[model samples]
Target chain A: MIELYLFLFIMLIAAVIATEIKDLLAAVISLGAVGFSVAIMFILVQAPDLAIVQIVVEILTIVIFVAVVFRTTHIDETIGKRFASTHILSMVLFSLFAFLFLAAVVQSLRELPRFGYATMRVASEYIRLGLSECGGANIVADVILDFRALDTLGEATVLFTSVIGVLALMRKIGRKR
Target chain B: MRGMSLVVKVVTNIVVGFIFIYGVYIILHGHLTPGGGFAGGVIIAGALVLRILAFGVEPVSEKRAEERASAFESLGALLFIGIAFAGLIIGGAFFLNFLPQGTPLRLLSGGIIPLCNIAIGIKVGAGLFTIFLALAAIKYVMED
Candidate 1:
């Protein structure tokens, strides 16, 4: 819809403004807002899981930024130079490529088979049988924990590694002192 | 540094408390709701950050929070692995749900899911909190 496009346009403008801002703290806050806006769009498109992940990651990133900013100068003097003519040229090229890719995707969608109905039917059937056969109360949870346990395990391992990495970084800082 | 306004302190504390409570609720009801462990954990960490912002870093006590979070992180990882091992001992596949299936779409249902959510919540909350504390520690160190 026109409204959706308009909203996206506004968000893009906000993102650029945020990045161009002179104040580092304000820029970080604006970037967080941009992330939230993208999360909202994701939810509007019926991707609640993705939206939640985006919001969480963005919040963490903002926290990290705040921590960094506390140690650094607030004024960002490089913004103007960073967005020079060469940078603008590269950005234009990047945008062109992205636009082309999106156009191709939209065009392909018209020719794609209408599998939404079939997918829903299969999912509903799975929900019914999965409960009885698998003896799991929540079908989605069953699929995630039982059927795709390996994926869950891998994700958990990644989280564990990141935790260790953080600890190690902190210890290194302590050692330096 | 100048003292903070009373209103700001009160509002920040209230918001932080709300975030913490909501995080716990989300983690507990993960199976029946949209929120899960990661989301809940991040919300809890956000609350910690809010506290840090309202109160100064010195008042927030990074050392104490780090100790607790590190312990929680280790415990969570151990518990998660232990649960998976329990499934193996029960002659089911790894991470299998050996418990009886209660009524669908109800609380206390999804045996392993609830347990997993709890483990994940602890792991993520502690992990994220540790990261924040570490970053704050870096700032403090650099200042000195």
Candidate 2:
């Protein structure tokens, strides 16, 4: 639909602007806009759960971005670079890559199974046996916490390790004399 | 870093409690609702970050808060692992449904899922707040 395409177009523009902007805060804001459009696209495609996750994650990302931007005055020195032959070449290459990426994404979207089409073999089983077998009314919760719990465990470990890394890095290196 | 405007601080004071409750609600109802642990954790972290933003780094007592966050985050991760290992002990498999599953749609119906959600909520919330504190304009934060 036109609305879907419109959202995609906005996302594309936001991506471009996010990179092109000189101010770090402006760039972060534009990237947040990109996240917003993607969340809307998720909603339009009948994935409300994904949409909720996307928006919440996006908000947190923006918060982090703002924190970094405000804490660090100068993010980079690349804004000084002006129009040049390399810049022109990079722009052309980026455009070609973006075109190819969009083409592949569109093709994959078209190939995806239709809504309510029951594509996966285990999909029906989950719908039928999830409540009885897993004893959870929400099939999604059952799938995550029961069926794919090991994966969740690994994810938790990863988060824990990353937090540890952050804590370690935040501590001052070397002892005071 | 200094705190924001008085209005922002006042609004944050009122809204933060509501945000914390909402985040807990999301985690508790995750088994029945669309959201789950990670999403709820992020919401909880958002609430804490809001307070940090309004009050700034000084009143937050950066070092102590960071330590608490790290501790809570590890506790959550350990709790999740303990649940899985407990399942292995009783059910002879990792992450088995060890608890007595009650009727569907009830709070106690999800066996170990609710506990897992709560653990994830704690881990994620604490972890994210730690990250925010690290990047925040604290004493260690590089000032221009």
TM-score of chain B of each: 0.89, 0.93
Candidate 1, residue A88: the lDDT equals 89
Which digits, one per residue and each the tens of the lDDT, describe model 1 over residues A1-177?
565576698788879888789999998988887888888887776657568768988987987787678657799998767778899899999999999999999999887667435444656677667666544554555666656666877788898898788778766444654
Model 1 TM: 0.80
lDDT (10s digit) by residue, model 2, range B15-133: 99998998898889888877888888999999998988898776347867887988898899989999999999998999999998899899888899999999999999999998878
lDDT of 1: 0.75
Write the residue-wise lDDT of candidate 2 on A1-177 in tens digits.
689999999988999888877788889999999999999998898766678779989998987788678867645568767679998899899999999999999999999898678688887887787888777777878988998899989888898888888767666555242
* Model 1 chain A weakest 10-residue run by lDDT: A133-142
**Candidate 2 error regions (>4 Å):** A73-77, A80-82, A96-111, A115-118, A175-177, B137-144
How big is the positional error of residue B46 in model 1, measured in Å on the Cα after superposition? 2.0
How good is model 2 by TM-score?
0.89
Clashing pairs in 2: none
Q: Against the hidden reference, what TM-scores do the models get?
A: 0.80, 0.89
